[model samples]
Target: GAGVSQSPSNKVTEKGKDVELRCDPISGHTALYWYRQSLGQGLEFLIYFQGNSAPDKSGLPSDRFSAERTGGSVSTLTIQRTQQEDSAVYLCASSLGPGVVYGYTFGSGTRLTVV
Candidate 1:
């Protein structure tokens, strides 16, 4: 794709359910990131994948949240045992590399609501 693309723009899931969010980044991008923004809060980093290197999972809020980038182009973020506090807009961004120089192209985001 020419730009970052995310599926299921809006998701409504019940408590304890699991949700999978997908992201397709621009071609040739080497870095993909997942973040989430809660109501009235700043974007919180979730996970990062760069090339074939091991992903930096330090930012994941909990074990229930995980992500992976495959073949360096597509990525998926999975949230398990969803909770009300997990409601937020999950954003995916991709860059040519892992620094400020390359900048980033972000997807519209998937709004997750837990009830």
Candidate 2:
């Protein structure tokens, strides 16, 4: 893809349902990140994957949240048992490498709503 691409720009799911969000990062990008932004809140880092290294899941809010990057390219974020509080915009960004020196390209984001 020419740039990062995310599927399902907006998703509305019933409470307790599970959801999967997909992200296709730019070619050659080694670092991909997942973030959540609640209404009026700053971006909250969820997970990060760099090359072949283990993903940094420290930022994930709970066990219900998990993400994985396949072949160091596409990434998927799965949320189990969605809750109303989980309603937010899920953003995905990719960079050439670690750190912000190379800057990052972000997607429009997937808006997840649990009702």
Candidate 3:
């Protein structure tokens, strides 16, 4: 893809249901990231995958949130036992590398609503 792509732009899931959000990053980008944004809130880093390096999972709010990148091109964010608090816009971004200098390309995001 020319830019980051995310699936299911909108999702409404019942509480306790699990959901998977996908992301296809731009070609040649080695740095991919997942973020969660509450209404009118700043992005909260969720996870980061850079090349073959170990992913940084520290940002995940809990074990129920996880993500992975495959073949260095696509990524998926999975949320288990969804709660109302989990309702937010999940954004995916990619860059040439990690750092502010590289900037980032973000997807429109998947708006998740857990009721």
Candidate 4:
């Protein structure tokens, strides 16, 4: 079983541009999550998907940030309009289920830098 992996690991864009971050989660895992972590702010859950359904979208900062899970495995996060305020580590994680009691693994993250 492979671990969750993220692409680019770093992204630099200008204000109002768009960016996409990719994630490949471990095989057989049914739950996936996206989070944002700023310099001082710790990990903040962005969205969570169980199987093919996203039950929570409360953490998404704005319309600019969105994500989707495919076939209950791979996932991609898209930022419609990148802003300096959107600069942060976009982290991806996967687990066996939805609850956070345990069993989640995180990717190194795609660091988005809006310049």
Candidate 5:
């Protein structure tokens, strides 16, 4: 893909249901990231994957949230037992590499609503 791509642009799930968000990063990019944005809140970093290094999962709000990157290309973010508070737009981005220099190319995002 020319830029980052995310699947199922919108999702509406019942509370307690599980949902998975997928991201396909640009080819040759070495860094990938996941973020969340609430209605009026700033973007929240959820995870980061750089090259072959271990993924950074520190920002995940709880154990119910998890993510993984396969072949350093595609990534998936899964949320279990969805709660109303979890409703937000899930964004994915990829950069040429880590640091501020490369910046990031972001996906439009997957909007999840827990009803």
Candidate 6:
């Protein structure tokens, strides 16, 4: 019944620091995705998890970024050595499947600011 939830609607960190963003997906949904949107840019898919396995991690930007999903429901995205360019909104979404046949429900997102 729940949608997706992300913590720290806004995060401001000094450069070279580390931050962790959390996501809680709806119950029974087997698919969870992480995406980031930079100013005036399209949503970039960072990683995806189906159940307890992650099938895609191609868009993580750099080795400084990583993520993990546990119990097939909750996910956490961590960014290490933050840079000013890393400032963006990290969004999380879950779907019935890849297509979301109906529509995709997105979290309000955690806005990160690396100063």
lDDT of prediction 5: 0.92
Candidate 3's clash total is 0
In angstroms, what RMSD does candidate 4 have relative to the true structure?
Answer: 1.3
Q: Write the per-residue lDDT of candidate 2 for residues 1-115, one digit (tens) a residue.
A: 8999998899999999999999999999999999999999999998889974545889999999988888989899999999999999999999999886978899999999999
Give the total clashing residue pairs for model 1.
0
Q: TM-score of predicted model 5?
A: 0.95
Model 5 misplaced regions, further than 4 Å: none
Tens-digit lDDT track for model 6 on 2-106? 778899899999999999999998887788999999988999989988887888999889999999999988999999999999999999998877666865678
Residue 44 in candidate 3 has what lDDT?
98
- lDDT values of the candidates? 0.90, 0.92, 0.91, 0.89, 0.92, 0.90
lDDT of 4 by residue, 11-91 (tens): 999998989999898898899999999978999989989987899989998988888888988898999878899999989
* Candidate 5 structure quality by residue, lDDT tens digits, 38-63: 99899999999996454588899999
lDDT by residue (16-110, candidate 1, tens digit) is 99999999999988899888999999999888889755458888988998887778788889999999999999999999888869688999999
Better of 2 and 4 by TM-score: 2
lDDT of 3: 0.91
Residue ranges of candidate 3 with Cα displaced over 4 Å: 52-54
RMSD of each candidate relative to the true structure: 1.2, 1.1, 1.2, 1.3, 1.2, 1.2
Residue 109 in candidate 1 has what lDDT?
A: 96
Root-mean-square deviation of Cα positions for candidate 1 versus the true structure, in angstroms? 1.2
- Ranked by lDDT, the better of candidates 1 and 6 is 6
Give candidate 2 misplaced runs (Cα > 4 Å): none
Candidate 1 is scored at a TM of 0.94
